[model samples]
Target: QLDDDLVSALKGALSGSLEALILGLMKSTAQYDASELKASMKGLGTDEETLIEIVCSRNNEELAEIKRVYRDMFKKDLEKDVAGDTSGNFAKLLLALVQTRRDEPSNVVDYEKIDEDARALYEAGVKRKGTDVVTWIEIMSQRSVPHLQKVFERYKSYSPYDMKESIRKEVKGDLEKSFLTLVECFENRQLYFASRLNEAMKSKGAKEKVVTRIIVSRCEVDLIKIRTEFKKHFKRSLYQTITEHTKGDYQKALLSLCGGDD
Candidate 1:
């Protein structure tokens, strides 16, 4: 169920700012004036921070309705306005928010990434030079787990050794362990990740990397949902999982994102 507090916040009024009123819009337009923005944002009064939360936080359908309203009211395009209005990670996150589809296009993989992952496994084993333990962790943590599933299948075909086992042999130190957990737990995630993370954290400073990726991403939208899945798959509490694995401010931010006890 949706949190009642968030639901109430969703129902909250807007201020004069474009960001503030846009959430309430069933549809919107580029042609809208300060007055419409005024009426939308007025009583409650909104600002950029609030807009970032609403726009970047909500999913595509909700954002789409707001876009529709913007078009109807202003008679201008929403994408162009958003394109003009935002940039960088905030913009990227917002666009990802707008692009609610999470499925990998079947053709997206083709043969390259498959070959790349396999070649990485067969050759150097680490896939570094930009491809490294950190990169693999981020991809697994952020992208669809199912996509990771496909990569694993391709990897199995590429080398005689299993990908995770190859990483264990090729990569050294905590880095190897981290990537191993990501791949090993990909299939039975809920059953393994938290414990694997705890095991992975046994090495020095390893937890820090995991904390930083999650905390720094500003991935408010759908992030908790990911955590929930992580927990469900790992058969462990995400909070207890993180706490057992990390320490300090980075852990705090990640726990917050996971909606966990800090």
Candidate 2:
């Protein structure tokens, strides 16, 4: 662990985006996630995109740790904070996820349950007149990734559109965004992150916080795979994209975290 005085000195020495990145790096993964969550909800308006991305992408254990750390760091309950900040079904979905009740991934796949869930989702959305947001929220927030993957595959046989398309058709606003993000993370987390990174830099002005969060959070996890996916999808390397969008020490720090060009 870094010493408290040393960490404070480094915090005092650094300024701007570089300080955010460096300080982010010093914390444990759960602590970083907790801080990011707090930062997203701080101030007048909430950053719904950041909240969605972080909440939707994390797994059961990771979320449990984040919720615990969030309370410790902020002296507040993560679930209550989410409920207070968001509204409607979006808040329901986020609160469900923050409960950390998702089943663990296992070698054993329950094909029967998969088919049942696929049917449930299909009936709830495409087959019915009105969408059942509750059913969607329950399945999406509680199922294991591997189970959901199989469910999505089976769902294609029942509905005209895939799960993501179905989500787009069924819901609107932040709820839709959260569901889609969850589906993408389920399908291919690294690829989803690569797409997010590309989107962050592709805008007129780069979304620096999104870029920093993705890079810093994923650096030790699957950044190399994300780089590969970035090149494959965008026809440009993430390193070059960072060079074009950011400047000075911020760019340098990002590039170092990115590891290398694809």
Off by over 4 Å in 2: 1-12
TM-score of 1: 0.32
**How many steric overlaps are in each model, in order?**
23, 0
lDDT of 1 by residue, 1-262 (tens): 3554653565564322222223323222322222233233334343433344234333334455666666666676555554455554334444454444434335464466656645554544433343344344334444445566767777777667677777666655434444554465456533343343444555675544333323333233344555566566666666777677666654554566566542
Compared with the true structure, what per-residue lDDT tens digits does model 2 show for residues 1-89? 35678779988999978888998998888899999999999988999988999999988888999988998999999999998899989
- Model 1 steric clash total: 23
Model 1, 257: alpha-carbon shift in Å?
A: 6.0
Model 1 gets an lDDT of: 0.47
Each prediction's TM-score versus the true structure: 0.32, 0.94
Question: What C-alpha RMSD separates each model from the true structure?
Answer: 13.1, 1.7
